[model samples]
Target: MSTLPTSRPSTPFAVVDRDRLQANIDRVARLAADRGQALRPHAKTHKCPQIAALQLEAGASGLTVATLGEAEVFADAGCTDLLIAYPVWWDADRAGRVAQLAARVRLAVGVDSVEAVQHLASLLGTAPGRPLAAPISPPTLPELVVEVDCGHHRSGCAPQDAGAVARAGVEAGFVVRGVFAFPGHSYTPTGREEVAEQEARDLAVAADSLRGAGILEPWVSGGSTPTVEHEGHGFDEVRPGVYVMGDAQQWELGTCSPADIALTVHATVVSHAGGRLVLDAGSKALGADRAGWATGFGRLLDHPEARIELLSEHHAVAVMSEGTELPPLGTEVRVVPNHACNAVNLTDELWVEVDGRLVESWPVAARGLNA
Candidate 1:
């Protein structure tokens, strides 16, 4: 028989099961390795260096960050190989900062336009008064990856225009590493497989186009949590972030099951009125992201029959389904947020757990580092 931890306390916090997370990490890492591809898990999910380190230990090559600030945080935490996987605009001041960052780590910046590449080249050329030794050759500047649109019509260049973008980057004095895409449309329930297939085809086309432009394309990356499981061959790497700790959205999309949900908010029932039981956690604790298809604000683990009908800043009113008993006052309930990423950003720390034992609290160091 297994013994529960006596030190366990009831607190409203995001609890991460080490075993489940590690299992997921290992499985995905093996899947990628078997395909002769690399797994560069996106760090935007947990935004915790410890979790990122676990991914690296589980055969992940490195990490993909969405912002420069996130890259800096990870770099400072001893992450040498980092990819800022978003198209970023750089002014004179921002360029100086990026140049400084480039000197510290093996960094790759994403580009979506010729103008962005030209700006980055100008930044790399001027080392901001810090010049390398006579023959050292000013630190082989940051490598650039062109963004392909894939299926999400967001920030990427068109698949047919990939060759032009790669040529433009080359002409601007930057080494075009390859191309990347987001494929965010895969988050929907019905379109996941189709979106993943589209991502593979788009990435393949983009790679061929880049090669046609005389550019030696190396990396063809794209992925998100919902579509990662259906990923196809040909891409050099896949970056899926939310698989670390699934949320209500992923549950509804069928990317994760209830047992796979490793994180939840522990809230105490504070009030009871009419036919509803009010919990202390609301939109502030659980995120306010309600997709059109999402069932409710969040699913109550203990009371599956209860519907989180209304959510205010600090209160959640749960209406018990017909013929269901209402939870008494002071009852503790667990809730999975609609979106884990937003919920994480709203909190400063997370309560780490293992087999129902409270182990430690990890700070969200990169929570507000959106700049």
Candidate 2:
């Protein structure tokens, strides 16, 4: 069992168990190594430099971010290698920021279209004309990675069309560093293993197309937390974020067990009337992100049968299972949010706990940097 602090600080606070955190980090790192692939975990999950350092120390090759702001924050924290895994729609101002970051760190940006490559090239003075009107040359342009739509119908081109975009990137003076895809469709109750297989097959076709375009042996990358366990060489690197802080969704999906959860919202039972237990940690603290299949807004850490049926700005209405009694008023409980990424972004700092004792606090340094 994970230890909790003897004296709780306050209600609606986020806490991370140090032992569970380290174990989770080490487990994923080993999984990648055993499969002969590099581990580049997505930092958008925890958004803490402290957690990033732990992942790096566990032999991660680099980190992945969702935006330029996240890349800047991680770079400033001394991360040398980073990849922005989003197809950034660029403007002049954002282009300048990306260029500055590229010069400082080994950065790579995602591209799914020839227009994105051309825009980036024009901004760097490598292409003919600037399309966005405001053109300023920068010292260096980041490397490019073509995103392939494995099965997720979001933000990627067909596997066969990857070469056209990659060839355009090469002609625009950017080194296209292979292809990557996220098996987001794998986050389901079934067919995840098949989705993993499809991810590898899609990435293989994309990599082959890159090879046909004269980009020899392109770096293939695949995997989300749900599909990372599918072993075999369909990728050169794996990026799985939520493995570090197993959430309620992951627990319900059987990706991680209850014992693997490392982060939770520590809330107090403020009321127990009307046969419903009310928790102080609600949407504001736990984050309002529930998938269609999610059982509730969140899950109780100690009470497996409890369900958070309703959520207000400051109250989480939990319905306990039959024969279960509600704790008295002022009782402290832990809650695992449906999505750890959104939950961590909603908080400013995470109280670190070790062996039931209060340790240090880590700031959510990259919080609210969603540009």
Candidate 3:
């Protein structure tokens, strides 16, 4: 038998099962190691330094962040190697900040357009601090990785255009280290392995293109939780973030198991009527990210068959299929969000627990670094 802590009364809070979190981290790390590739997990999922440290301790090569602000926060947390894996539009103000960061640690940014390359070359070319672009003719600043679109069609040039972008970066005084892609199309249940195969094929082509332009290794980086579905070693690094905290989406997609879910939203049963219970956690607590396939706003972790039919800022209506009884009012239930990324950004802190024992609260240090 297990005993749970009933010391306080704080509902609508995010909870982290420390054991599950560690297991998730170790699973990915071991997978990456077995494949002989580096693991630079996208930190946008957790945005917690303590968790980042856990990843580092688990032998992560570095960290992948979406924003410079996130990079700064992680850098301050002693994460030296950072990759801003987004096609960041370069301007003087942001470049200066990036240069400062470069001076402090190993920094890399994603590039897509030649104009971005030109602007980076202009501002970072042989400038005092760390240059954003560096040429083979002359050593330069931060590394540049071309973002390739692998079936996502969201960003990056075609696989054939990888060389053009790498050439532009190299000519503009940027060290074209490699190419990266996001296989977002793998989010579906049945298409994950195929998408992963397509991603590998695309990266192989992109790497050849870069190598043709004198850019080697091409660090072909890509991986989402779904695409990590089956392992094939093509990309140098895989950036899977959501695995850190499995969500309802991952569970529904069959990408993760319930035991793999590390984070859950604790919501109180505020109202009960008509065989339904309304939870205090709503859009504000869990975030409103309903994919076309999502069953509802979120799913009850304790009651996997139950669905949150409706959600408002402060209410989550729970509806169980078939004949099922709703927990009485004042009962607390845990919800796994449809999307963990957005749900985590909405919370300020996460309650840490190990083996059903309460631990401490971990602040979401980089929660709102949207810029």
Candidate 4:
């Protein structure tokens, strides 16, 4: 007895506006180029090779990922260069996989301690013009990047400790290429600029320390969606994610306007009661990441003032303000989730939209590759 919203692709599907996505790509690429920084956006945000190709076309120097599985996925998809931004803990079994991957593409590994560099050396054998166990070749050794603490304090060494780490890499016959850090502390609403400054200062100190230890030409890399606009001092590269598909957190932090959001969940109204409407897109469709300061789980596109107070596996409870109208059952509403990364991991493909018309689909090839 009810008609479905055919204008919408389907309930609980992620829709990416083609034009907005391209605009985001071009904007970030141009800004980085003008600022003399190489942009190597984290692929963990979109996780789609099509999107990665678009970024490459827009002049991305390389790609960054959070896990080896993601690196494998992208490498198989023809990404020639990638950086595993996380300080990976590799067991003997995973070591083989790392070697196999390094043999194929230009790979970089992040490490914060001498122990990590030692483990990496044992795995990759020796660097160029060196002797090692089993007489392994040099090109298979992945480049080692010392990850220094830049105020987020998640998984990096102190500025003073970077020299020790880089020296250890050099001793182990690994090429210590550069330094990188993630300024996740900028994710808050009020501290974007300050945390970005912290990132720049910390990185500058670490780079200087490496140079003092006789490590010349140390490349510095740092950036995040919250603090990307701030060009950190001495940073030659930036690895920013979530900018490609901004979420509610970025909007709240003033990083981007509503028009800049390229990804949205298209959900249909399934029920309504007492000024509250339920949508078919819930945690299964949208991500379950609620920032400490987030007002709700997601925001409605048309009704920006509404709040998604509760979310289940199959339903999103949207609470409207006083005297606000509710969308009728079977009506479709677009929701911008709180975290685009997690929201994207929940989907298999993104429905591409251009000028209110369905154009194509982009597969999330690296979804569920957390290992």
Candidate 5:
């Protein structure tokens, strides 16, 4: 396994391997292209304009963000097409922002309820307290993508219930672009193929329902890192984020190999006592995102036999397998976070490395924009 930089700024900073990063990006782009599906990668994972630009340059049709704040950041950074893939309730402030963004970029958002659709329509009719310069231009309304529950049952409506929301969007004068779903249940050990099929079937049914309700050419969308490569199956677009930076969960889930992992937290072993090593990075840097099946808080990039058993704000306790030698104190090591999205969000910037050498720094431009 390749190691991280020896002479680094400090411990607990994110280091992205440029070579591996580009390989991951190209692999996904090629897959989506070959499948004849648009790749609008979710930006909530990296939250960096530099990475988004690479994705776009590699043939991404657009971007998928979790929040309007993220949409605004990408818009400012020159992403012309974007989707806020969350069922956002448009309050007064958010309504104004969404409207303003729609006027500039090809923006679409997820919707799951007629009430939210109605609220969106009512908000777009006028400017705050006054009538618009002209009536709400249907062409200018942010496009809507009805959300359908493909067994995740997290936020989307049932697949059968998607038509009502699509109808409400059309009635409200918004161009109902299509349907979307996050098969989050696919993160399990054996759920990827099953949920990918479920996502495809459910989206198809929802699209047919949209057509039944008078919508034509409803765009189908679905994908997560674990399921993105499992064939889109009549999908027009896919939005997978974590494939860009493989995490410990992906590594353990067999979704990605260690060589495919592009990002890790560079930390120094601060102590070695009682046959255990304590590192400077903890939950605050690597993120506390252990799933029930996860072996530990994180993993060692170089030492696959080592497990990060515990994490505090600034310390991580790692235990190596019996017979493995413990590193000396002050030895720098790389820690692969359990969840890359959360890990990236905790830092302000990523140290980009090429061929094991520091190259540049990419700011987490969309960090803390979860609102």
Candidate 6:
């Protein structure tokens, strides 16, 4: 039997600069504070408890997750307040787990259907059969946040349908606390301003609809790193996860310049063939989420002019520009991944660095907890 590598590998790997990460955290926190908006950064980007703790210590109101398992991971790590931002479907089994989770933390679940609301209410309204941990007061019951489709066209109800959903949640014994949206279309350069505007307009309309339904505590929330800068004043909270560790997508959209990129795959040049340099890192390590408008699989930091023409599971082929000299074989270089969230999940642990020296390692505790 072969043993796994327990220590940092001598070969190249993903490196995270603690200083850069902290700086990005502070900058974004300050920006949200300046706008008087609460910051509950999405933890799905890094999926590391250390990074989450840093964001909280730097003044984040709470953490936002996309899965019930993610919520459980953070809650087990002592995170008191958590928001499951996805419009999750619930049945008897899932609702039972959700009710159990609500008992441990200040929980908020997103709902886009009346059935989901009714299901959650039925679970929360009933008492647990056995105490999982130390006996305490019965759970306060989780809050519900109606998801409004603010141009993401993803998993959310229409802003016009907000009132009906809020009314349903209220009647189902769930407290309709606020509205949430992704505004994912804002990731593109040309769609940024318009999407941000639409997010604001949609959230405002949804909040009004909820208010008309007699729900006064309808907090408006929306965000994505590209559109977060343009978030309007009416939103009570903003959740931008990728700002902590920028990716090539953010770089191309001008959300973060090369200087702000904190996470990169350190790969070695294994071969040079016919004006092309092959790197060791590829789809498996760097991810294969290339935006339709993206230039390549990933960008080579050392040779900004070079294009990664192809990416296989274990190899990346970078075509050097005319008159550009390729680095020597066995040379290591940094690669900015296309999607930071996926890239982080691909690794078991991350290598922390400071001033070019290895400092620490952080386990990807919630990497595969996607349930």
Question: Between the candidate structures 3 and 4, which one is better when assessed by lDDT?
Answer: 4
Cα lDDT tens digits for candidate 4, 1-371? 11233464558888899899999999999989999889999999999998999999999999999999999999988899999999998776667787788889999989999888877677566533445645444347778899998887789999888988999888887778889999988888897888888888888889888887678989899999878888645679999999998888888878988899999999999899656899999898897889889999999988989999998888899998888878899998999999999999999888888898766777899999998
Question: For residues 144-193, what per-residue lDDT tens digits would candidate 3 score against the true structure?
Answer: 98888889989888898889988988776667879888889888767788
TM-score sort, best first: 2, 5, 4, 3, 6, 1
Least accurate stretch of 10 residues (summed lDDT) in model 1?
Answer: 127-136
Candidate 1, TM-score vs. the true structure? 0.91
Answer with 1 or 3, whichever has the higher lDDT. Answer: 3
**CA displacement after TM-score superposition, residue 203 of candidate 4 (Å):** 0.5
RMSD of each: 4.0, 3.0, 4.1, 3.8, 3.5, 3.9
- Candidate 5: global Cα-lDDT? 0.90
lDDT of 6 at 156: 88
Question: How does residue 147 of candidate 6 score in lDDT?
Answer: 94
lDDT ranking of the models: 5, 2, 4, 3, 6, 1
lDDT of each: 0.80, 0.90, 0.86, 0.87, 0.90, 0.84
Candidate 1 lDDT score at position 195: 91
- TM-score list, all predictions: 0.91, 0.95, 0.93, 0.94, 0.95, 0.93
* Candidate 2, superposed: residue stretches over 4 Å from native: 1-8, 128-138
The residue pairs that clash in candidate 1, if any, are: none
**Of 2 and 6, the candidate ranking higher by TM-score:** 2
Off by over 4 Å in 5: 1-7, 126-139
* lDDT of predicted model 4: 0.87
- The superposed Cα distance between candidate 5 and the true structure at residue 29, in angstroms, equals 0.4
The ten-residue window of minimal lDDT in model 3 covers 131-140
